[model samples]
Target: MDVSKDTPQAPATAAVPDDTPPEVSRRLRLITLVATFGGLLFGYDTGVINGALPYMTDDLGLTPVTEGMVTSSLLLGAALGAVTGGRLSDARGRRRTILTLAVLFFVGALGCTLAPTTAVMVVARFVLGLAVGGASVTVPVYLAEVSPAERRGALVTRNELMIVTGQLLAFTSNAIIAQVGGESGGVWRWMLVVATLPAVVLWFGMLVMPESPRWLASQSRFNDALEVLRQVRSRQRAEAELSEVSALAVKDEQEKLGGWQDIRSTPWVRRLMFVGFGIAVVQQITGVNTIMYYGTQILTDAGFAADSALTANIANGVISVLATFVGIWLLGRVKRRPMLMAGQAGTTVALLLIGVFSLVLPSGDGRAYAVLAMTVTFLAFQQGAISPVTWLMLSEIFPMRMRGFGMGVAAVVLWLTNFVIGLVFPSLVSGIGISSTFFLFVVAGVFSLTFVKLYVPETKGRTLESLEAELRARFS
Candidate 1:
């Protein structure tokens, strides 16, 4: 059920009740950094392709269809990776799963860097997709489980910040590499290789980090849960939080709630899954990836020369990172549902303008600048509102026992939506021209707004366990 803004409620605060020791505070910050390198990899690997693809096209002899294939293959692999990664984290543990994914990140990057054939490149990208998909699910879930209830939104959303930071890093790296090697061949390979360093850092970092206390508690290891919690939280608060989490963990195991059968059989789980799937689909249908994955091409179509388009594309990455900073601030001050509605509305208008600018303006600087303005405006709303909320809400809403699996399934839906959009966007522009293609996104934005207004629930300012109980009562 949607919570009304006027409803009586306590004031919002991100402060944990217990005072944190300086060492614990530093440890918490360090953990956030290390864990978010997974997010960094997620950003760099996905965003690097945006700049590298043009060069790769020439090097690999890609046609339009093959170009789409190369781009979409990683997304296709992500679709598979989402479910598999989620399940692995659920059965094993969050830290363990992330450590394994870091290795995948390394291997996948190396494979893509060295591939001599399009077939091999496609295969390597798919392998990288696995790491990307796994990181998306595991990193946020780990952060959510480890955070204080009051700070969960801010802490968990750090992954989203790192994601865009990685993207910016990719954009910056791509620009530098392109410029430095303007006369040389295979610069995209250098772009692809930058991702490997972070993968190595994430692997070494995860080796020293503590596992999720909630996951350990869910396994009936109460003592271990407290120990893990203490690594991030103050001793008194860690103990207090563990008591509440332990009670839920016991009830969860008693109920044995997990997987497809559990989700189908339980009323609230089914409803949450429905909501989760809708959230995932809503995010993708906005066509944000078109900008993230193919921003250079989008700018080129807007009229800039190829080299100029690559440099102009950096604006998109910069706005995404800055807007995410605003989003992290907003997540603390504003309610989530309204932020989502506002974002959708902003993006819809931006899309409408993009179509208008394309259809009415003649090919030249004016048209290009107008569309560029709209794309930047569109991403400000998207990264600030929609993307962060989508990921944070999915991380928040699932039952503790099945958080990994539930989010995995929703992420599958997200990635599949992303895959279809990535696969068809080139054809979409080819068949309909730029104006009509954006108009289609405008229509999608309308529906996405309606869905959120009526069905999406508020998840702000609550612990995951409390949120789950509230949802169970309402859905049941």
Candidate 2:
């Protein structure tokens, strides 16, 4: 598809001309960087366990089933956190909600680092999961609402980039720290401790950041929202943007705003939620976490030594970060629906190949390398194509008034699906073996592709209000 090049001009305000001064752009970038620390924490907390788990199990004396529970409990907490956070952000405000989550992240990290038993670790991890879940829903929505439409895709996707980068940091740090503290009795505690640094940064950074202008408008705080827009937007543009957002907010209030009842009462919203749920489900069913949370174990199962597996897993983290960069670039240049479908296609083929390689390749040097190559290829497609687009679309598709709640509901499905996959993956691998587990992902990928091709709407180029009207008209 030919990409559109229309950069959204700043809304006309009294303090600036039609063209924004360079200082404004610089400030906006700074805001994006600070807010995205939430994503970094999200990634590190989820991925840190990949390396920490083996040591944790040894220290805590966990069984296989309990190990799965330990890994997935955080995900389950995330599922609840996503929905709760989304709703609270809508009712409260994005900045406040994130500030709250930052505290949770810090407390959760501390709890995990200090836990003395498996049961305590599970509870502590679940607390961390709440922050992760909240961040996944709140950060993207916060970024999208604050960003200019022209740079929206890139800016919103910056969070995804950071998320993968955080995961890479986790993996790299785990490797170095494990090697350095290898002889220490509580070595994994150090792995869990590393997350606290980002959490602290997120909290301090957000304290000075402005609240989402759109969110402010939703609460009828036009003056406060305008002040926020002025910080990152040119004065003229900020006033114009606030006016536009305010008009929509008024219309939404007049229409009685959002709830489950609102969704059920409105056919178009119900349909959009369904699409969102499908998008979330499809993203998870690819079995990405199987590789993420269990990549080291999978490598060991494929014949690599434990140390070799740890070293090799860094490749997975690196490729994920790189692929996310590609994905963010692609988001700016491609239609959302087609990009999603293409991602599904790429992941399907990669999963099929992974299954085939495991089934057909002989064990030893060639098999391990081949499987690793296919795993990297799968990450390239999955992270680059499917993952970023999924998050971006969820953040983009909802109406201003319902943005938080709608995205939250969709994210709830996403987190729950992730939870189920994370919970069952170890068992699945043990029960069905490697080849069949991947084959299962291949089947799910095909179904996901079909869902995107047939049902997912194209959402590029349109403003959030325009998209909502378009979807309402189409579905109505």
Candidate 3:
């Protein structure tokens, strides 16, 4: 029952029939488009709050602490969702889990749209966070599973693209809505309801999509796995790939590499989880979400008028989308560890400049623009290198049987870290000032860079099965 775990000296490779049929390729593209709606939802739900919060604050009568609660509640919910969604996907099915999350997205959006008070909004945002956390773990894993190893990076990264794209859409929508409503009492409600359309789309689209072949194989449904593979892969390639996938699935079955028992009792798995935890921390510690959730405030604090800040914030969303596009291209051309380290270095430098500008410059347009420039630069590295690699590696590195479970646990760390930062960032800015707050992120970036060098493994140019085998051997 011992699977052929790939060793460093002898990594496995397949010389399969490379000609994926045109129809099959189209089907794969379609599947990717449909599944990534979860990601779009993730982006919109999280990003909308950045713009909506200003209006929401006034309407909901929020204090600074209550504002933090309103913002971090979804993140807290996301922390719960990461573990809950991962386990649910592992036990029930990724497709089913996403379906359930879609319903939550719709309900959560409706709740937020109609919320009469801060408490109701907090609860609604928490519900929405569940879907965000679920999609963060599930969509990439699902995309990675269905994609060809050769095209895995590009295809799976499409979800990352959609995420930023959704953010850009939110920013644009928020700006437009604000202008149209012109300081209306409930402009944020319009922002919250936009997410419901995508949620409905995700539910309907996933209904017809094929389940992950890897998931089917893990369940001992070899015939079903092969059938699903055949729909997306050429007949010869499907047969060849299924043999390797099924053998690994059987080996995993023998070892029961599916849950907390294996993660606790198996040394290799425990190490992998540790590395997974590091990866999760590395992504969050970059403080990328800080900009995403509060770019408007950051700009305003730097000296922009409130209305000016909201409009300028769209620039952050635009750059995020552009940076992610660059990240996807680099994933195909570069190794993961180097890209991640490079990203950390870039972000660290950007944070330093932001802090320096805020600390030294007078309250003028010059300093405001300087800080805005650095924030955009920070996102260039964050989205382009760290964010894509974090999600892609988490999706790639786990044993097939516990892919969802392992990634889920790691994502819990990610979401919880996000929750803490989201909750504290407002207070930090208020108490310590913008200059010192960014200095803290600069310090975190250094540690994150060191962790990547020492612990993170490269995952490019390898199939998930082969990578899993290689990781198992390395850890063991």
Candidate 4:
């Protein structure tokens, strides 16, 4: 595939069709709801820190470097977790891996809630990061595998919706908790503890959820795969879908398609991996997590009082949820490549404005509100377009046999990029001021936009099996 060459919109290839029974549709919706709780947890855990950090800084006596550590520790753990979780889901089945992650989520959250020392907090957050990273890989892959082709974009991106909703929940709760607790010594603990409830919900929910049908097929358990598929698809559609999935699964196994070795030796697979890595890096380098992990601090630096910033940060969370909703709807109607490029362009412009505003607007309500508005605009483009498309494309681009592993590796790159940004952002703001820091992101954004235009493929509107075949032929 000459990535620089344009990828035209693919004609929508219908999956099994809308002839599914009511019961089957209900089952599928239930599975999506349950599975996406992982995304909710992902959002809450990451976003809670945004509000928690200032309070934590007071209690822990955190230096800027330590604050960075406290925030980035989970991201570092996530980098490891992405690859480890990927392999685990591939070997142990997606449902079981998520079950284990839910347990980790509970334990890690509890640890964070009770931690008495900075060291303990970092380790605890790392543990949470592991679960977050695992969920990031497993949940979407699980959703992608089970969804019918026509509905796959909407279904898979539901996880993104949950992620932002989780963030919104964290922001809302953090504001409430901070307001109620005032300057109380341990208010951050309250913020951290709330995550435990959802972890419990996710565990119990997955206990009833079926394993990924494609995973079963990859394991050569065709009967089991078909049975699982039938829960969410009509019998005839289930049978037809299983035939296509199993054939690819068997071929993938014969070709030994599911490991690093295959990625290294196969020309097309290697090319796909390059694209996957690019996509992952592109998603992170836009500096979205800088806002997510540090939005409160950013607003404060921009001139809002700490209390006001905490409250105002809710707008970021709210817009993220709303934009993700729009992203989900748009995913159904737009081609992935163009949507992604448009998002990149929108966000780049937003970041540039934020930089310019922070630099020239002078300190006060005006600077604060301008920065806030720009952040909101940046997120609208991000959650609505860049994020959903990024995760959806990652879930779709890999081969069936190694879907989890491939996405995991790419996610590793994404988290590492995020980790670096989260770790450095506070210092960057303190060192050169907020304006220069955002200007840096603006430059990165321009590069990201060009990369997406030249390299990313259009992925919407194709069955996973057919998409894989097309990629193989195009790259070959």
TM-score of 1: 0.97
Write the candidate numbers in order of decreasing TM-score: 4, 3, 1, 2
In candidate 1 the C-alpha lDDT for residue 59 amounts to 93
Could you list the CA RMSD of all candidates, in the order they appear? 1.8, 3.3, 2.6, 1.4
lDDT digits (tens) for residues 1-476 of candidate 2: 11122224223223234477798888899889999999999999999999999998888998889899889989998998999999999999999999999999999999999999989999999999999999999999999988876678889989999988988998899889889988578899999998999888989999989899889898999999988888777777777777777887898899776789889898878888998999899989998888889888888877788778888999999999999999888888987777787778888888898788888988877878888888898889888988888898999878788898999999899999999899888888889988999999888988888788778877776656656666676666
Give candidate 1 misplaced runs (Cα > 4 Å): 1-16
Per-residue C-alpha lDDT of model 4 across residues 122-177, encoded as one tens digit per residue: 99999999999999999999999999898999999999999999999999999999
Q: Mind sharing the TM-score for model 4?
A: 0.98
Query: How high is the CA lDDT of each candidate model?
Result: 0.90, 0.86, 0.90, 0.92
Tens digits of per-residue lDDT, candidate 1, 35-71, equal: 9999999999989999999999999999999998999
Q: How accurate is candidate 3 locally (lDDT)?
A: 0.90
Better of 2 and 3 by TM-score: 3
Q: After superposition, how far is residue 16 of candidate 2 from its true place, in Å?
A: 13
* Candidate 2 error regions (>4 Å): 1-18
**lDDT ranking from best candidate downward:** 4, 1, 3, 2
Clash list (residue pairs), candidate 4 = 1-475
Residue pairs in clash, model 1: none
Of 1 and 2, the candidate ahead on TM-score is: 1
